[model samples]
Target: MLKIEDLHVAVDGAEILKGLTLEVPAGEVHAIMGPNGSGKSTLSHTIAGRDAYEVLSGGVTLDGDNLLALDPNERAAKGLFLSFQHPIEIPGVQTMNFIRTAMNAQRKARSEEEISAADFLKSIRAKAKLVGLNDAKIKRPFNVGFSGGEKKRMEMLQLVMFEPRFAIMDETDSGLDIDALKMVGDVVNELRDPSRGFLVITHYQRLLDYIKPDAVHVLADGRIVKSGGPELAAELERSGYDQFIEAA
Candidate 1:
């Protein structure tokens, strides 16, 4: 449901992503793996329309609509969600309120009715449980005092609640244990519809074991070096990224 064509990007006048391209169609999962500084995160940020990461050239589209032309908020409103590698800690903002506002924002943008408070709680409570989080965790300030794995769990909570048409998860498995990683897989599999797509950017193949991506891409030095099936992820784990790094 997302396409990137010969994408080029920069931030504050420095080049980052150079001629990168990939596609994640509906009902499929794609994993992007690479060493540090290969523009994995930049690709996600640029696709999400994050500020400062200017698209110097090329195009990104969500189901044929120009994604690069939209603002970050607009992209989000279009059912595009990016789960950051590091979730911020908003000490005073209740997690419940934050998610409710975001969900309502998307709904209002689409001319859908705002969820009733009772409905919001009911919906998110079910989603929260799906992500292995309890009601108390959802009641806390967003990510405040949460451990790394907990923050990742919180991100999954949002993913489940939002149920976006397309999601770009950046380093979502960074700190997750096997249980949390499986939670990620469960939520993804549960949301796997013919209208939903996912791009999972990660550094290791362990997460792939849980999600079973439809395709695997090796990104290095700002471009994709190899594209293969699930077997490629396993190959990389056995062979290492050293070859791709050199090729990049």
Candidate 2:
């Protein structure tokens, strides 16, 4: 559902992603593993249309539509969801209000009806519990005073609530305990459908154990250098990224 071709991105005039090309078809999960400075986050941010991540060349598209031409909110309305590696806190924003507003905004953008308050409350509560978040936690301000794992759980809550067509999970497993990892996996697995796709960006293979990927790709020096079956993640865990770093 997501296609990126020869994507060269620069941050502050320094090139990071050099000729990176990858694709995650509908109904498949693709995991990208690479060491630090391999442009993993850059690729994610660029695809999400984050500011300052300048796309020097190449193209990114969602289901054949040019994504680079659209703003980030537009992409979200198109059913593209990005689970941030570092989910930020908006101190003044009420968690429920923020999420409901976003959900309705996307729906409105797509010419759909807004979710009623009663329905949204019921859905969010169920999804929050599924993601290991309590009612008190969701009642708090957007991620205010939440632990890292809790924040990740909050991300999953949004994921299941939004039910996006394509998801880019950027290190959702970072700082997560085993239970949190399993929760992340459960949410993704539950949301998986023939019409949905996932691009999982992670530095370690532990998360892969919980969420079985259809393909594993090795990213080095801002480009995807190698790709294989799930065994590729196992191999990387055994061998480390030294070989890929040197090869790049």
Candidate 3:
């Protein structure tokens, strides 16, 4: 299980996540929904160990391992992955090259054998197909010239290829069409199992239609305002965030 203990995060002396606490057990999916500026992204970034996502207080752990003690790469090596809503564009890095490097780096850290080029190609090709990505698209520079939906698909591709222990997808369906949303759901459900967990953060309930979360959390003003079953998402969809916003 991933235990977040009253995590307080600040960036450049500005507090963002305030005493946020949550738990994501293995084999379950948790969705966090909230309005703009509700500190949702900060929680994801802090958990992923991004630079300058300074830890003001509290702790985060996976199983018994303290996650706040690791660097970003260290966290990745320990099986924590974050899917950005707006994936960055790297002009010079090819998609395959980056994934291979990441895979090898993780293996090297754990003293495991490196994956062969042929095997790497096979694995990526299969995962790309799973994410509805074509060979040519995967050959392009990372996120370069890709649409918003395609960038999200690329994120799913990585999620499937790595099959990390925990994944935080931040607003992954922001610009996805209905078809893309279904594809997102397909990718997530395919990765579901007893050893992995997901923290899905989004502003809309449409994405939840594809990936039915076991629990839904409403985060507002840097704290969880309310939490309930999947029906909570439907309620939010019908009534909107107005009531929750006021409560928060």
Candidate with maximal TM-score: 2
- Least well predicted 10-residue stretch by lDDT in candidate 1: 124-133
What lDDT tens digits, residue by residue, belong to model 1 across residues 1-248? Answer: 79998998998888888899888888899999999988998898899888879888899999999998888888999999999998899999999999999899999988999989999889889888888788999999898999999899899888888889999999999988899999998888888888899999999999998899999999998888899999999999999999998888
Model 2 alpha-carbon miss at residue 165, Å: 0.5
Error of 3 at 181 (Å): 0.7
lDDT of 2 by residue, 108-193 (tens): 99999999999999999998999989999888899999999999998999999999999999999999998999989989999989
For each candidate in turn, the TM-score is: 0.97, 0.99, 0.97
Considering lDDT, which of the candidate structures 2 and 3 is the better prediction for this target?
2
Candidate 2 lowest-lDDT run of ten: 131-140
Q: Please tell me which model should have the higher lDDT, number 1 or number 3.
A: 3
Which stretches in model 2 have alpha-carbon errors above 4 Å?
A: none
Which prediction has more favorable TM-score, 1 or 2?
A: 2
Ordered from best to worst TM-score, the candidate numbers read: 2, 1, 3
Against the reference, the lDDT scores of all candidates come to 0.91, 0.95, 0.92
Top lDDT model: 2
lDDT digits (tens) for residues 102-157 of candidate 3: 98998888788999999999999988998899999989999899988899899999
Cα shift from native, residue 165, model 1 (Å): 0.3
Q: Which pairs of residues collide in model 2?
A: none
